[model samples]
Target chain A: MKLGRLNHVGVATPSIERSVAIYRDRLGAEVVREPFDLPAQGVRVCFVDTPNSQIELIEPLGADSPILKFLERNPEGGQHHLCFEVSDIAQARDFFESGAVRILGPTRIGAHGTPIFFLHPKDMGGVLTEIMESPKQAH
Target chain B: MKLGRLNHVGVATPSIERSVAIYRDRLGAEVVREPFDLPAQGVRVCFVDTPNSQIELIEPLGADSPILKFLERNPEGGQHHLCFEVSDIAQARDFFESGAVRILGPTRIGAHGTPIFFLHPKDMGGVLTEIMESPKQAH
Candidate 1:
């Protein structure tokens, strides 16, 4: 699969507000998008834009949310996944399948409004990986 | 702290040889630096360059290595940390200190031969973060 760039590092957080402080007050970050809920994904997400990439802060929207389990494992929350861009989501998916690697599901419109799919953590050396369309602005 | 770029994502592995195939064969990575042991860090390390950043693969060097514990928790290996480049390591260290955040120690030479320091995971949203001097090739 042709990997494009490191788009963002997904950080699972118990509270996006607190996470914002770390990036803003601590790191002196200037640009942080407002937190928005993705009901379909069962999480509240926001983007902390940096020079090279983004820090994606994600908080569980409900008790049964997938992020809740991650939180349980790490109450302090942590780096949940690494997302890389790809020019072709379909080709990326096919490449994973051909290599006997598991893709979580069909590509769906992710928080960035871009085609995205997740690769199983087991297949990625225990690191959850996200493959997404590169440079998508929903234009 | 002036974050320069996402330099690399550190991945702890059981064996660099097995990890090489995942990057070279599966991900089509073209450039992978030779694996070398960092005795002081108690780990073997290598770099796999990507478009935006590189992947630093690290394996425990001996029984007493700190990574052995990480490997114990994650037998298949896992993402260890995220390293971001900083224009000035001293300024970054001061920034963290001014915020009452913990720094593992004073800056020391890292795998890249650049002055680097680690931020305690407890203070970094559960992600062990490395702040390093940007683009230092040690000429």
Candidate 2:
């Protein structure tokens, strides 16, 4: 599989507002989009654009939120995953599957409006990884 | 601190040779530099150059290597840190310190032969971040 650029680094946080302050006031980041809810994923997210990639701040939005357990383990939150773009999500998924890498779930529409799938941490050397469609367009 | 490009994402591993196989044979990475040891840091590292940034694979050289604890917690190894380039290391260090951010140690030469320092994870949203001088001239 051809690996593309680093799209974004997902940061799980208890509050997107607080994460925004750190990226903005402390890091001198000038652009931080307003936080929005992804009810489908049960999380609120905001993008902190960087020179090369971005930082995606995500906060649990519902009781069944996937990141709820992560927050329970790390109350102050932490890096949840690293996302990389793939020219074609399907092809990339096929490649990982062929290599016996475990993918978490079926490809779904991501926050970027692109099809994305998360690779299980165990199969990814202890780091949760997201593979997303490049030049993301509505899926 | 002026954030330059994402230099690389450091992944701690038990073996660089094994990680190289995954990147080269599976991920289709074309360039995988030879592994070298940094005695000062007590870790061996190698660079896998990507289009935009790079992936750094680090293996502990000794039992007391800082990464040993990480590998202990995750026998499979894990993402150790994210490194970003900075035009001036001292200036970036000053900015972080002024913001009450914790610096792990005095600036030291990094794997890239660049002056670098790790910011305390607690002050960096639970991500151990590295700030390094870019276009590193061998010191």
Candidate 3:
């Protein structure tokens, strides 16, 4: 698989509003985008930009949201996943297969219009790993 | 506090060598530094360079290491902390204090020569955050 770059780091939080304030007021990161509700995923997401990479703050909007259960177990805070920009999603899937890692999706368009797939946490140690087609606007 | 670019994202894993192979062979990240042991922290770290930030794969050197405990609970995989580079560690501590979040440390240098401090995970919704002075080479 041809890896392009580190896309963005997903952060799970109890409240997007609170996380936004902390990222902005404390960390000096600017809000690149406002919080958007993803009813399909049962969460709300906000993007913040630093000098290098973006931080995605996610808040569970429904009880059934996976992030909700994750927060319940962690309670403090934790990273959701590390997304890597890939040249080809299919090639990435093939690479994972060679390593015997389960691929969650072949290639699906996600929030940012990128074709992405997730490598099961069991294969990647404990962190959720993602491989996605490089964004046109990627640096 | 003047925010510098992100330095690295730390990931705890059972074996640094295995993680390194995946990152280097599959992700195309080059191993910029060899593994270094920090007895005080009970960790051995290897650094990989991404386009925007570095990835630090940490392995606990001893069974009593804090990372060992983390791996025991989160056997799947997860990020350890998000580290940001700052121009002044003291200023970063002051900035964190001005906010509602509690600071975990103040201007203490790490084994890597960067002065760092942590923000209490409670305020950040469980994400262990570190603010540090940019490494000499980074500056």
Candidate 4:
């Protein structure tokens, strides 16, 4: 697949508010958006934009949220996933198909109207990966 | 601190060679640098540069390596630390001090010739964060 760029970095946190504060107050990243709850995904997300990339803070709203479980097990926050911007989502899917990696979606519109697909972490040595195709809005 | 940009995303893995292939072959990130073994840290690192940020694949070379111990606990790879580039090394140190976050260094450079410091994960809600001054290469 033709990878465009590093779209954004997803950070799973126990509290989105706290994470947002750290990024904005301490790191100097501007808060681009407020927390938006997504019940289907069991998450409340906030976005911060930097010069080069965006920082996504994801907090689990329910006990069943995967991120909640993740925090329960590993409290230390680290890299969650690396998203690569692609020109064609279908072509990106095909590339993963050639490999043993499991595709989570063919294509789906994400937070900012960007098409994206998540690769199963099991296939990528436990690192969650996402391929996205869309023009990101400047915050 | 005045954050410049994200320097790189660090990934701890069992095999840098295999990880490098997956990132380069599947993800399409160009291999800008080769694997370099840091004997002092007991780990090997390979760097891939994308448009926005860098992907670093790290593998422990010895049992004493911190990566080895991390892998021992979290065999499944996930998010590691997120590093932010700072314009001034001393100012970056001051930020941490102002926040009462424990600082790991105001010391020597790593990988590239950039002065760096680490904020304890406990202070950042389990996230390992690094503040790095722009490298001399950019000067």
Best by lDDT: 1
| Chain A TM-score, structure 2 | 0.95
Please report the candidate that would top TM-score against the real structure: 1
Higher TM-score: candidate 3 or 4? 4
lDDT of candidate 4 over B16-126, digit per residue (tens): 777777777778766458789877657787877887778777888777887776787768654567778887888778767878578865555666666777788877767
Fraction of real interface contacts that model 4 preserves: 0.63
- Cα lDDT tens digits for candidate 3, A45-131: 887877887887888887788788788887755688888887777777777778767888456776567788788877776668878
lDDT of 2 by residue, A1-139 (tens): 7777878888899888887887776666767887889998899999987777788999999899999999998787888888888899889988888886888989998988889999888766677889889874522
Clashing pairs in 1: none
Q: Give RMSD to native, each candidate.
A: 2.2, 2.6, 2.3, 2.3
The C-alpha interface RMSD of every prediction is 1.5, 1.7, 2.2, 2.2
Model 3: lDDT of residue B18: 82
What local lDDT score does residue A111 receive in model 4, on the 0 to 100 scale?
A: 57
What's the CA error at residue B17 for candidate 1, in Å? 1.5
* lDDT by residue (tens digit), candidate 3, B1-139: 5445767788988888888777777566754578888776688888877776778788888777878778887764458988888877777777777778898744566646778877877777677887878766733
What is candidate 2's lDDT per residue for B1-139, written digit by digit as tens?
5557778889888878877876777667777888899989999999987767788999999777999988988787677888878888888888988877889988999998889999888877777888888875522
Candidate order by decreasing TM-score: 1, 2, 4, 3
